[model samples]
Target: MSRFLLSASRLLALLLCAVLLSACVQDLTGPDDPDDPPPPPVRMRTVYDLKVSPRYIDVVGSCDKVFGSPTAGEFQYRVEVNGEGRTNGFESQNYNSRLGVVTGRVAGQQITFAPRTYTWSSMSSPGRIEAVVFGTEWDGAIRDGDMSNRRGARTVPFALGRRPGTVTIGATSECRLVLAYEAEWVQREVPA
Candidate 1:
């Protein structure tokens, strides 16, 4: 008829330009169907399991949080205490009943002081403190210049908070694991 109406008007303008170019080619990208790669970076350090009983097996203690590790650096976080369970003389610093055992590093974890404090010896040697929380109740751990007690087990010598009426000692049973740190970078809070 006019070459079949000009080939049906060029097939209706190529189907109306492929329906307006698929309506302006919209996809914006959302479902490529193959995504599962993001989760692998753990082991700087983060431990917390403080279980206390304290009725006195020579009283044990604990505090928590080692996560991602970063108290400052050089070596932050390492406070290990063990109140002689098998009694090799627990935390044996030559195990002399640890001579007036004291470990009080206030704010970051490590509280227990008394390296010999007596008004004049009425016979009072009681020391065990752990509870002063305004925002941070840490005892110790964030070392660099060798704070000693390098895991051979035997770390108790801090003092900052606790010494009045002091009564956290046993009649409670046992539980101690005080170790703290929060400086920054190198366990870098792990999120890369």
Candidate 2:
């Protein structure tokens, strides 16, 4: 009986030491310490269409005199959007007409514009796309580093908010430009 008890005690002690060793190994091989990952992608939608007709009531001369070009013989509308570091152009028109269409994602939430203190310009010309709200019943213009254009095609930079929520970005040029956008958020796990 004494010999049997001695063997049992030794076995229990061995098991306890094994359990402690296993825990120590796990702590050493755990997940790496790093910054938190980015949030998931969200669904966006255009709830209100920023369609507004230009009255051309506030500018000097005729609507053509203020907005249209004598050489082109038509109004030039240049549209540009800042895609962070990359600027994407929608389309340009050379006739006296309304602005282009801006659509959001499938679902809805307003777009957030994170204002950055820097100058953004077009690669093709010296003209730059200024960060100003358009679509109002007012005339937008160019000043210094600011950009403005009539109904002409152009490329400009735009900023998007870091999180999924209501974001409103003003028109890039000087004119009556209005844009409405909305978005829906979804959780996604980005791979490390």
Candidate 3:
């Protein structure tokens, strides 16, 4: 009689174990478990379109008309834009150094230059603007208050472009005046 009772108790335990196993299998096929977390949201990246225009001006000396190559001559320049830890440059040909124009003006129609385009990763800060103008340096001797050998190789600097547009700096020479062709970055909307 005791053996029969032990056998019945073992059968009951086996049945309980099977029930728990079956419940677990069903739970996996159903909705997600309470302890599981949902996936994170996806983030999209944004890009911007930027237009870089490096404007330049002809540094015309007062004596250009008297002893220079051309009171109005076509001069070439290599304009470099440096600021905000970024550097970009462009070279222009047949840039008309207009004669008798002592004032700095927009060179869009007057001179032939290449437009620089850039893609801005972000608009955090548009760095400080400085341009290093490289062209024929003027090496002239003053005789009778007039300059000779007006055309030469020279490197000039425009301290900074605080704002967008034309900026001028003093040539720091008695005979020559400084003119700057300024360059800047223009922010534009992304194309559709």
Candidate 4:
């Protein structure tokens, strides 16, 4: 009986110690400190639109407001005859450009939002909004205001153009349309 009591007491003591140790360690993933002001809100937005149908579209870009500094990126695009181009011009001029456009947040190196595919909701934190910019990056040109060649920069009044003809366009830009005092930029959290 005494041995049994001793063993039981030892087990109880071990259990108590384990409980106490676990309690001492708190969960680290709760809300941030209220005192710590949230990180600045960074968002990507479209300021203007470029229409390309006549083969020589014009682009004019500028940000009405700038919150912080951002880097400028570049993209490469191509022009085809309604998805009809020879990759090797010698053979058929079948070219595929994949239309590259380097985008970044309005200013920060890191982006707070990304593109989402939802039917009814609006775009969330994504940088470049997709609108039939109507131009190929080849003939497409951003004139006047020259953004820096540095990565992770932002440029206002980005004006780019493309040659006109049956044109369809999509984009993922990095410029943001956020005020300086926002936090945790959000886009369609979920895509449809």
lDDT of the candidates, in the order given: 0.29, 0.30, 0.41, 0.29
Q: Per-prediction RMSD in angstroms?
A: 20.7, 16.6, 12.3, 23.0
Extract clashing residue pairs from model 3.
55-181, 56-181, 57-181, 84-127, 136-152, 137-152, 137-153, 137-154
CA displacement after TM-score superposition, residue 113 of candidate 3 (Å)? 1.9
Error of 1 at 10 (Å): 11
Model 1 has an lDDT value of: 0.29
How would you encode candidate 4's per-residue C-alpha lDDT over 26-95 as one tens digit per residue? 7889767889987876664533232212122122222112364333323222221111111110110222
User: Candidate 2 — which residues are off by over 4 angstroms?
Assistant: 1-76, 94-175, 182-187
**Which structure among the candidates has the greatest lDDT?**
3
Clashes of each: 39, 27, 8, 32
Each prediction's TM-score versus the true structure: 0.17, 0.22, 0.38, 0.23
Model 1, 38-123: lDDT tens per residue? Answer: 67766543221222121111112222225833232111222222332311112213221224233333223344322321111111
Which has the higher TM-score value, candidate number 1 or candidate number 3?
A: 3
Q: How many backbone clashes does candidate 2 have?
A: 27
- Model 2 misses residue 93 by how many Å? 2.7
